[model samples]
Target: MTTAALGPNRTSRLAARRGRQRRWHRNRQPIGLLYVAPFAVLFAMFLVWPTIYGFYLSFTDRNLAGASAPSFVGLANYLEAFADQVVWRSMGNTVWFTVLTTIPLVILPLVVALLVNLNLRGQWFWRLAIFMPFLLASTVVSQIFTWLFNPDLGLINAALGSIGMTGPAWLQDPKTAMTAVVIATVWWTIGFNFLLFLAALQNIPAQIYEAASVDGASAWRQVFLITLPLIRRTVLLVVALQVLASIKVFDQIYQMTGGGPANSTRAILMYVYDTGFSNYRLGYASAISYIFFVIVVVLSLVQVRFFSRKADR
Candidate 1:
């Protein structure tokens, strides 16, 4: 009788333990979910909602004028943009600027980073000086350069004349306006890329270079065979950044040229601004913006694949 009574009591105790364990698990689940809730809400509110709304706006004939409802126009905006000569011309100029700027922006910075990495005096000073321009506001840099590029009384013109070379009308001439913008962008932003390269260069172990020297490798040979190969990831990162930045160049162009001199320096961003604000064709501008966004996305994916393959090798 005693043994049978104790068996029932022991079984009841085991059941109670399992019940408590289940309740504990249930309580912890909600806490975990609570931690993720804030980020999820913000991501949905800011990123997801705006993206969907923008896509919807692209199909409608919306404007900022009156409080009238948008008329659904389907693919009309895209068709109009495709047929427009100015749209195509602006796209060409944007691509040209991106290509021209990306090269110098990637190359010059890497070279400067390498030189700065050498055993030289005042390393901090050199780094600070190079990076100072990046801290300036885009508008400030653009305004300063605008004054410098003035044909009549600009410092740049004066310097060129002193060297016995005639300077072109940088902002007035359609031919050289885009080039001037590219030059300004490079000087203003190359510092960021240089700092990135410098950091990557420093991360590389000094012992590796010392070993290369011990094996009688010349500086150029060591750079090609070891240094370049080691910092392949940083190079790709710098290139990708420059490409994206060059594509979405708006502030500098807006402040410097205002897409003037016969639209020679006009970028796709300027085109979007003109369509949306100046012309009040919000739907058409949204379509162009989406198209450009898609292009950038695709290009970024391609570059990632290319760089990933190289890193793997």
Candidate 2:
């Protein structure tokens, strides 16, 4: 074609392209926002806005039963939390519970996963049985354990009597209440860690064990020198997860013991709930929850670091 004809054709093409680009530029953000709008609204409504408002509420006298409007109280609630003996006791109970439960929750699951990973005769049954409790509702588990731990007419005490031993009041006694809650939490939640460990175990190459066997490494030796080292990261990941979950314990404990006999099993979360709803002190409850939130953030950072270091290794 002649230069004049080609020039007109190119001009028309460039104009069309520019028009399309302009249309796209006008539509991109809106289209993207439209796709994201549902999740954004839900997240803000349930998580972000509540977190922001709860922080604001922490600095006010926002009593649920108060007839007057909430007034700003500055740091008074926080100051009171620091001085409150029940706060410290509940916090201590939470820490103690975390300590007790984290050990078995992490260790027992790995051990069970290891045993199950041994290719037992009834693999499906073992796996399902080990994991079934985790699927139970917290309320249901609480009820089951409550009955099991009953001082009278319960199988646990009945078995104890058969063994010529008397069982303590698991849910009623201050001494054993937290212990009972810990046992329930372990039975209810250990399956998750077991699954994690089992997955990591399965991912391990069989040749590594074969190589270890060829080298005359005993079964226990292979576990110690090969399997464990390879799954070290998984173990740490489980520990971190268990720690965080144990710290937030409330539901089963609440349903089983009601934070009794003398509030021995009361977690920090229970304290926060009782403060907010039961006592109608919303401001104090918010402050305690925010404090707990900060502690959790710090703990999460530490756990991430612990998990990251081994993974990087």
Regions of candidate 2 where Cα sits further than 4 Å from its true position: 1-30
Q: What C-alpha lDDT, on a 0 to 100 scale, does residue 2 get in candidate 2? A: 98
**Predicted candidate 2: what Cα RMSD to the true structure?**
9.2
TM per prediction = 0.88, 0.89
| Model 1 misplaced stretches (Cα beyond 4 Å) | 1-27
Instruction: Score candidate 1 by TM-score against the native.
Output: 0.88
Best by TM-score: 2
Q: Residue-pair clashes per candidate, as listed?
A: 0, 0
**Candidate 2 TM-score to native:** 0.89
lDDT by residue for model 1 over 87-139, one digit each (tens)?
88888989999999999998999999999998689998998888899999999
